[model samples]
Target: MMNALESSSTRPYLIRALYEWCTDNALTPYIAVLVDDTVQVPREYVQNGEIVLNISFDATSGLKLGNEFVEFKARFGGVPRDIMVPMDRVLAIYARENGQGMAFPMPVPAASDEQDDAAASPDESQTAEAPAGEPAARGGMQLVPTDEADAEEPTDPPPPPPRKRPALKRIK
Candidate 1:
């Protein structure tokens, strides 16, 4: 038997909940992920070690929000491809329209010394310290909050948007 922490992580459950929330509201769900060797995605679509995917029901087929990974098949540039993203690699899940979403702090992966030396690189150590949503010296840039508004935005905006939106409340 395994302990609760060892058996499951809260990340996947949150992902599933957010996904369901998006679908329930008829919102297009998008997920930003860090691309690595374990990820299976179209290399051409990836930008700067990251990829944002449209995981809406219309875009993905056989979408499985599993505990370990999110597996789905979607088309990229008209070619269907299977995309696999580890739950740990998911940085955020947001609605494409208004950008209401939750950003997850990147989990530090355990260091492994016994792995093949051929795959090891000097830069591997740098990533372990750089949490998601922050920039690293190695030049990997994560999304950081900025106060500057969009340049093209209306100087005098319309009335304020509505408040009191539906949100998931965890019991524990």
Candidate 2:
């Protein structure tokens, strides 16, 4: 028998489900990961200690969505790069088209790790885990649902002309 904390994590399963959902709906699956020494990704591509990966069938080769890690080979700057993301480092998995998917809680660092970093940065160690149903912040990034007005717009506008009316407006 295992205690609640000892049970296997559900993050991998959710990832697989969302990946399948994205594919079935013709959406591109993307995963946001918190980069650390343990994570293997292109250092140049990481920004603000985070990297968003496209996990779609078109983007990756030999992709393995495993219980412990998300392993894949992807091309960056036209060069092939092997990527490995530990399950704990995954921040969110969603579709690029509509941003429909799930956000996961950040992993709490082990007591030993906390002790090692305490001398270097005391403030980070003091942050508590999020409540049962809320997503936690990691590497100074927190994902919270926000309205369109609150979301930041891209600096470069699309080249196409703006539509006079919304495309397929939903009436409630």
Candidate 3:
């Protein structure tokens, strides 16, 4: 029994979960990511490794992985560009961080169901797909600096490339 607001809030999380499920099942879920109201790009862009600015877009645009930092690419004033920021990057998302942030609970497979699926085919056991999507599960928090920090003085210039061996003249 969830209220309309609660249901609405959960949409993004559901979308994310579906995307994960699709990926686990070897399916590609098409996603349209919009940054800053003006620019939009496909989710493949993020998958391809590009930094992008954060901006609010239609909820139907796609699953928003909130509370996490993501780097993506977008256009600024009709020019191609790239940007990076935490999930908390967008001003709108920050405002909705409390309860409006999306969430999707992981689907639990029943033990009997699992057994049935396993009995159905031997190969299925060999290919138990990961439950989550990209950004694999991590055991512990690791601090990673996004920008340069604690600059160190250069100890020495980079070693130059090895010179080619001189050709030897044939003896007469």
Of the candidates shown, which would achieve the greatest lDDT relative to the real structure? 2
lDDT of 3 by residue, 31-87 (tens): 322233223344344432322223333222233455443334545555554544433
Model 3: residues with Cα > 4 Å off, grouped in runs: 6-8, 33-64, 67-172
How does each model score on lDDT? 0.79, 0.84, 0.40
Model 2 TM-score is 0.68
Per-residue accuracy of model 2 over 1-172 as CA lDDT, tens digit each: 8998999998999999999999999999999898889999999988767788999999999999999999999999999999999999998898888877888876778867767887677766565565455446544455468998868887887799866832221111
Over 4 Å off in model 2, which ranges? 118-172
lDDT of 2 at 151: 88
In model 3, pairs of residues that clash are: 36-55, 51-72, 51-83, 52-72, 52-83, 69-87
Q: How much does each candidate deviate from the true structure in C-alpha RMSD?
A: 12.2, 13.4, 21.8
Prediction 1 TM-score vs. true: 0.66
lDDT accuracy of residue 77 in candidate 2: 91
Model 1 poorest ten-residue lDDT run: 109-118
TM-score of each: 0.66, 0.68, 0.24
After superposing all C-alphas onto the true structure, candidate 1 shows an RMSD in angstroms of 12.2
lDDT of 3: 0.40
- For model 1, state the Cα shift of residue 57 in Å: 0.4
